[model samples]
Target chain A: MLTSAAKTALYGAHVSLGAKMSPFGGFLMPIVYTSILDEHKAVRTAAGLFDLSHMGQLVARGPAVAEWLDRLTVNRVAGMREGQARYNIFTNERGGAHDDAILYRFPEDWLIVVNAANTAKMWELLQASKPAQVALENRTPQSALIAIQGPRAAEILAPLCGADLDGLRSYHALRTRLADGAGGVEVEIARTGYTGEDGFEIFLPAGAAPAVWERLLVAGTTHGLRPAGLGARDVLRLEAGMPLYGHELDEDITPLQAGLGWAVRWEKSDFIGKTALAAQKAADDYDRIVGVVMDGKAPARAGYAVHADGRRVGEVRSGSIAPALGGRNIATALVAKAASAPGTRLTIEIRGTEHPATVVPLPFYKRPA
Target chain B: MSQPADRFYTKEHEWVKIEGQTATVGITDYAQSSLGDIVYVELPAPGAALERGKPLGVVESVKAVSDIYAPLPGTVAEVNAAVEDDPALVNRDPFGEGWLIKVSLTGDASPDGLLDAAAYAEFVRSL
Candidate 1:
């Protein structure tokens, strides 16, 4: 089965570690090394390493690179300073999301990290809308991304990194050297993560990934760093109130409906989906995403019907057992505005039985300051 | 982990330990491992009738929900409350403290369709 899927440079390493390999985003990726619960706890309490090579990395360079991207995405890309990373979303003409992405501004070029599943689509979109001046390149196949996430991330990475780890702020990036055995490997380190933790994501050549991964593992062993997988990553993102591409923000779901209006720059002169998004904002009656906590042991699941006052209102987009919330079942549902208020009683229909759930605020878990 | 030699297994990865007219049922270790972390378990109440190869309850992990099937025809005599309270027991001790249900075998009940320990191990390997 793995033969049909693309393998990362760490494929052999993951196999040797007895990781459960599964297909994700067109790649044969590790789903878990030991158990999801153990890995999730490791990321929360200590630190966890992740193979993010499957994500897409697109590089664009030109004088009008940021300006052209500003017209295509829903955020202010042109105003971004060098070494800054901003979360942005590409939307369709109808205000539907094409993909949620992070744009990292460099001195000479911009690196856009997109969802792996949307890599092909995003590349086509960029090329079709590209002007004569902007040059676009897909670096995903040649690049590998590794992320060390959690409270001990900086402590584990400071010794190996040449850049000032303590000085790096969140959503900032720097091109630096990672200490290898004899020489240094040039890499880009970004202090951004989907897990809502203090972390750093390293982007480097694919050939350099395995060695870096092993080096980090060796250095992090005493710090309780474990190799987490996609299963744990999914749980962590959900607990952090982050959105997954297919679940929370798809082609039919807009940034406004997903509670990401802040990512949408309405003040921008002109962008795709501006008109429709403006109308949706004016109406303010669109069905929106809300956080839910089930009152029973049965966990809510994606596509489960959500009902309020005996009427079908929405369906769950993503659901999982939230370890941060003490093993309680949590979910995100796209429901009508009337049912989106916090403390609103809602019911999730599971296997023809209605289970009690309450509408709470987004972000089921928050890191202590 | 090795399957208990005294039990009969099903193709769906369920194990049944039969003694006299009573049978204890639980999922195999492979099933629990494949399901990852177990967070919830729903079972039938005592006195519910179950047929062979029929859905009995659900076992939910953080990522997925799997249906647990009955191994033989029986009347549910008791349910394991420990698992419903702490579902991780199914992942920790799947055969012992994680036993899902105990059933009184029906009059026509038979283990004809079930496989023994060796056969079940081979079946798992074939997968």
Candidate 2:
């Protein structure tokens, strides 16, 4: 079976490290190194390195950049100052999500990072809705992205970074160089991560990825850093209560129904999906997202039905045994508004039997401040 | 990751050790590695009857869920409670303490259709 899926710059490195590779989002990505549990725990306790280059990078520049972005996403893009990043979603006319993206403000252009699977679709959407004055370019292939995330992330990268990693606040980014043991290699460092822990995401030239990835692994060897794969990343994000595009937010699901109503700014005068989302907020009558913890050991996988009062109430969108939570079976579900309240009792149908579960707060885990 | 020479293997990646009329069954080394981090295992209770090529239990890893099939027609004689408590034992020792269940033979122990250690090793290589 031959696959035409694209490979990242670190493809050979992953194979050399004995990683289990699988097809994900149009790319052959590493799913695990040694084990998902070990990598998941390593990120929570020490540090973890991730290759995020498969994600799409779109840049829109010119004086109309801010105005164009304001009409494109759900968040307030105009308010973002240079060096700041904001998380937002692109919704269709029916208030359904196209993709969740991170927008970073720079002096010349607004960099939009989107999910790899939706890169082509997002590019077409941006081009069709773009203002004539604004320029749109897909920079995914030209750039490489890597993230070193955990409580000890700064301690591992500080020695190699030329800038002050300590001063950089969350959601802030800076232009810096990494010492590859010989000299400074130009890169961009952003204090952001999907895991709910302190970390830095480095963006550099695609050609420099292999060298930098090796350098970071060596630099963090004493800090218990491990090469984490997408399997660990999924569990980490789930534990942090983050929503993935395909699993949690799809074309049929809106931000409000997916527990992302906060990201949709009703205060904005006008934007895409503003009318439909406003109607949803006003009605407050639709099914909404809820976090649930199973009373038993079995995991409630996606598409599993949820029940209450012997009737179907909803379905699970994302779930797994939270390794950080000592292998607790946790999941996020879209249930009826009546069952969305925290502490509400519900039953998740795992396999063929109903398992007792309770509606809890969104985000089963949060980093201690 | 070595297959014990005394055990018989199934094409679906199951291993069986038949001693007289009692047979101990578990997954092969390749199956455990492919599953990655076994978290839970659901096995049949003692006295339950199972037919060959039928699902007798379920083994769940962090990545996926797989069915554990009965190698031959038999009734459950014993179940490994230790695996229910700590599923990692299946990954650590697939042929020893990790054995899923022991079944009492109700039909002819069909050793004819099963693969020995050498043949099973070749089958894995062909995959």
Chain B TM-score list for all models: 0.98, 0.97
What lDDT tens digits, residue by residue, belong to model 2 across residues A147-196? 99999999999998889988998998888889866576888888989988
Show the colliding residue pairs in model 2. Answer: none
Over 4 Å off, model 1: A1-3
Q: Which ten residues in a row have the lowest lDDT in candidate 1 chain A?
A: A1-10
Over the true interface, candidate 1 deviates by an RMSD, in Å, of 0.7
DockQ score for model 2, please?
0.86
Q: Give the top-scoring candidate (DockQ).
A: 1
Measured on C-alpha atoms, candidate 2 has an lDDT of: 0.90
* Most accurate candidate by TM-score: 1
Sorted into a CAPRI-style docking class, model 2 comes out as high
lDDT of 1 by residue, A1-369 (tens): 344789999999999999999889989999999999999999999999999999999999989998899998898998999999999999999999999999999999999999999999999999999889999999999999999999999999999989899999999999999987759799999999988788999999998999999999999999999999999999999999999999999999999999999888878999999999999999999999999999988999999999999999999999999999998899999999999999999999999999999999999999989
What class would a CAPRI assessor give candidate 1's docking?
high
- List TM-score (chain A only) for every prediction: 0.99, 0.98
